[model samples]
Target: MSTAPHLEAGGLLLIADESLSPALVEQAAPVLAQGGLALCQGPGSPSGPRRLVLFDGKLTPTHAEALRGEPPALLLATRASDGRPSTWEARLLGDLLRGAPLLPAGASRHRLQSVADISAAGGAAARAVTQAGGSRTAAALVADVVHELAANAMWDAPVDSRGQHRYAHRRSEVREVAPEDACELAYAVEEGRMWLEVVDRFGGLRPGPFARALGGWG
Candidate 1:
């Protein structure tokens, strides 16, 4: 059970956590191979840098908090309720595999200065996704997603010159986002999908907590 990532120049690797079902992994691997990257397969062991662990059980934010950006990123796969793989994010994953980010460079960008801006962004996102033939249930989640991400950018992301938290202590204030300290949101709609990206100039997002809280978003 050496669950280290298959780090031998393979582009994308599919591996499973010991707790993840073999059937789920078997069903998902080839289905996601079309991204056209140099994908590979192997049973990566647990605990290491740059590990993409798949599992079937519920995981907590603490799990994500533990990683703390040592690997800088991760992706986890789980079984769908219908006993198949969940491909809801396949489009985004495909885009990532293709080496494009910010969810496509042409995504529309929005500036966030207040809660109203967050709501507007979410509403527009949901509309674009639903109108593109995406699932309404999925579209409904846009608000929650955008809200949390935007809140992070406005509150948790900002720091003073000494890297001390600036707005983190004033969330109750819901302080107006200064022009130079605003969160930037970008999104794009496709035939049956859409991507949302939030960016803050601070560039100090913590991966672990983000992973924990956002794990079940998609």
Candidate 2:
């Protein structure tokens, strides 16, 4: 997302060359509709619920032609700003392709109902990871993600009836989240994979603003 250009059109999530024709998406519908992801290659984005993947981030014309359907693509991002894809990106794509459930059902879960709980969750993550035979580095990473997602859920996701952020500005101050405003964090560690999930009760956040965040009814 930081470097690769992405587009949301025709219910497709396009991730390809800026030079690629918009017509490429014209033929594709929402491939993610079926809840299963398709890894399409070459042009003609999957007409159904499938996602197109490009091997090269610096897509040449042929690569561009690979664009067809936008099925929640997860490109390998070869040569992103650096010579290789970011570790998280590579790991994420690897995880999805490996077919493991993004959030396993047996994961340990935690809740954050107050700002104080955010820091506590991070500590719990590190301890849990270590107990599960994970390295401190791995533990640190998951803990950080947990911290962030908790913050976003509590502060970034809330919107009031007037469509204003309920507590975004007060993010700097410590406070308790009302029971209804609480967020959940869950994690699971498999032999080779680690998964983290954060659930905010409010789907109140939008892409950029309160109106769009509130959806069409806003």
Candidate 3:
């Protein structure tokens, strides 16, 4: 709903439907302008790179599918009937528009195997973040998030020929992550934001699980 004071100007494009309430637009205008972005209301598509198309209503599955191949980053904003953003919707928009890296430049990346490797990668990322002027709390939070991401990639991602998760039953115990099942960890700090990403080679995340997680069903 509001922009962070320390955010650096970054290129952004917000596309909202004409049906969106003027009140909502008024609330979002300053935040969008503060981020150095342009906002357009209409059905017409705009041209350019680093543009983020923001759907300013409930994003149905069919609508999401239709926009799958569209150019530019797609961010959905689901608002209540009264035109107020839900907590998750607000957070998602804040993260996207806060000038953080979509992909960090000059990031430190590591191929991590085993719990020890996860720890090392997190420590390295924390150091990088702090050296870039991130607060100690931010560094610690980034490190913790990286650790959890790495753990999920290592212990919950392997699939077998029968389509069963190889380590699902053993999630509670620590186990060595084989080199073949290793995950990639990358992190960087830019413009007062710390960016962290974990990549699992299996690419086995399904929509059902993702939806459930998002809905806090687990």
Candidate 4:
């Protein structure tokens, strides 16, 4: 079993957006409650003061109207460009939690070997932070962001082609895999910036908008 880094406590406050499925909402509720994080619950109407507001898909006019009264401490909206399951929802949540405040994703760090290892790579990275005594405030953010972008490269990149699969994660850099199906991933911390790079020899495919969006989270 993998041991995640130690997680600091600020408490996660999850505001379920209207777009979230009942199942996901249910799952998050217990997790936050267990962690002692406050869960914001009220009428769906957006009118009111709130720390943060999360929505399932694009905020509809009604949703927006409700929010007009409450500017939300932060706004998170999900959208599916590739029609992948929960990918968009995950992206929105990651973005709001990270407070990235930027558009257009970052550049690639390295080429990855086989798409199968994206989850493993991300999981490893998140585990490293948690085990290293990082903040759980963004633990899920780091994990999901890395998992989605890295996983996208594996499934979307050409089976024979190889391009650098790079990503920026919490206070670390990662570079993994190149020639062999089993490449290396590197993570380092510098000047309070985390870097993650993945190197793969196969070079020829381009990432799609959906994958690109996920990568741009930072």
Candidate 5:
């Protein structure tokens, strides 16, 4: 089996249900086009590495189930609305379109092994942001996000032989992350975009649970 071609700067496949309102489609088209992304309707599978953007008013269990078996790269879901993409979504799409690294070129990389390391990495990222003329508030926000990502990567990531999360039920206490379980934190700012990435070696995130959690689908 051959892999699909990656979505490039002008190649996006927007899938919508047949019952989706024309008003919503009108609202979404300009946003995608302005971002240099091509748009199409329905569920036709395109060849190559194309990113899949599903605009279905809101992501539901059905949508989540449809995407469950696929690899979770460059897949985005958005509500059908008149507004443009949110900042986070825009950045995500930008990275996908350009095939950019999660952390941009010249990023500062850190190997984090504990809560303290996560904190230090966040601080370093914030400092880098401020030094590059970004506002203090922006820097602080970036730091906070970095801290959260690190926490998730460290505490919520590890799985044992039985597919159980090692620290899933642990209380909020200081725990030392083992060297082998360390996460890589990287951040960089380029061309008015700040890129940050926290990588845990174990790719344990599942789409269904994540979607249900976010959408309150339970």
Candidate 6:
């Protein structure tokens, strides 16, 4: 009997980071698709974990379905103020995906109140994956998604005085570690799955652009 050739699994990679321009995201789609991967502009992705890249958005039922199984290596990047990818970030994501163990059974859910808490919650979620013996790629994905959501919320959410402006200018301290001052949110971890939710009183008042973006990620 002959063994079957290893086939690259197909899955979805949702982009939620509003900071990332549609053009940049559209450009990466081809590369990812070539490897049997795809990019979604909303929260819902396929049921199997091919490669879901969440930028800054909510998780829809479709997105949850796509994340059910073990995911492929994750590629995360740190961007500059000008919205360009940083060399260090690119290398870091590449290295992690190339070499990271897999923690097969852990699911986490998070709910944030303010944008300030996004990074912290994400970092915590990633560390959870590491502690659970899962691949760092999965952990990185969770962190990156949280980071993206936080960024969008801070910039887009409705504010009392400034109309949803947390950081007028990019601050090194906030960017490096968002949870420290990002706000107190809710999160949970169990089994091998993770869900993060960002809630605000103003959510009902007006849905921002990120909400629409999340829908497309799926």
Q: Clash totals for all models, in order?
A: 5, 8, 0, 43, 6, 46
What's the TM-score of each model vs. the native? 0.68, 0.57, 0.58, 0.31, 0.66, 0.35
Candidate 3 vs. true structure, TM-score = 0.58
Ten residues in a row with the worst lDDT in model 1?
1-10
Off-target runs (Cα >4 Å) in candidate 2 are 1-51, 55-101, 204-218
List the lowest-lDDT window of 10 residues for candidate 2: 26-35
Give the alpha carbon lDDT tens digit for every residue of 17-136 in model 2.
343333333222222222333323334442445333434454333332233323223434444453333444544544565576567568888888887788888888788889888898
- lDDT by residue (tens digit), candidate 5, 37-141: 555443345544343544444655445544554554344445325443444565557666667765556878999888789889999989888888999999999
Q: lDDT rank, highest first? A: 1, 5, 3, 2, 6, 4
Model 6 error, position 77 (Å) = 28
**Candidate 1 residue 134 C-alpha distance from true site, Å:** 6.6
Model 1 C-alpha lDDT versus the unseen true structure: 0.65
Q: Over the stretch 1-218, how does candidate 1's per-residue lDDT look in tens digits?
A: 22344421153335555565544555555545543333444454333345444555456553464345565544655546754445554445666645667375578888998878988998888888877787888888876898899988988888888999878888988657677778888989754557778988888865655676755553
Please give the distance, in angstroms, between residue 53's alpha carbon in candidate 3 and its true position after superposition: 7.7
| Model 3 residue 182 lDDT score | 83
Using TM-score as the yardstick, the better of models 2 and 4 is: 2
Report how far off residue 163 is in candidate 3 (Å): 1.5
Q: What TM-score does structure 4 among the candidates reach?
A: 0.31
* Superposed model 1: Cα runs more than 4 Å off: 1-13, 21-28, 40-49, 60-69, 79-91, 97-99, 102-106, 129-140, 210-218
Give per-residue lDDT, candidate 4, residue 34.
Answer: 41
lDDT of 4 by residue, 1-218 (tens): 00111111133333544455434444444343442343454333333344344455553443433333333234434333432224333433445456652222442233345444665666666766676567775556776766655554443332433443333231133334344444435554333334555443444333243344544454
Candidate 6, 1-218: lDDT as tens digits: 01111122234343434434545555444444443343344334334554434332334433333333354323234244534344434433444344532222233445454444565677887887777777889889878876776555543443445454444344343433233223323344555555454544445233333345544673
Instruction: TM-score winner between 2 and 5, please give it.
Output: 5
- Model 4: weakest 10-residue lDDT segment is 1-10
RMSD over all Cα atoms, model 5: 6.2
lDDT of 6: 0.46
The segments of candidate 6 whose C-alpha lies over 4 angstroms from its true place after superposition are 1-118, 161-183, 204-218
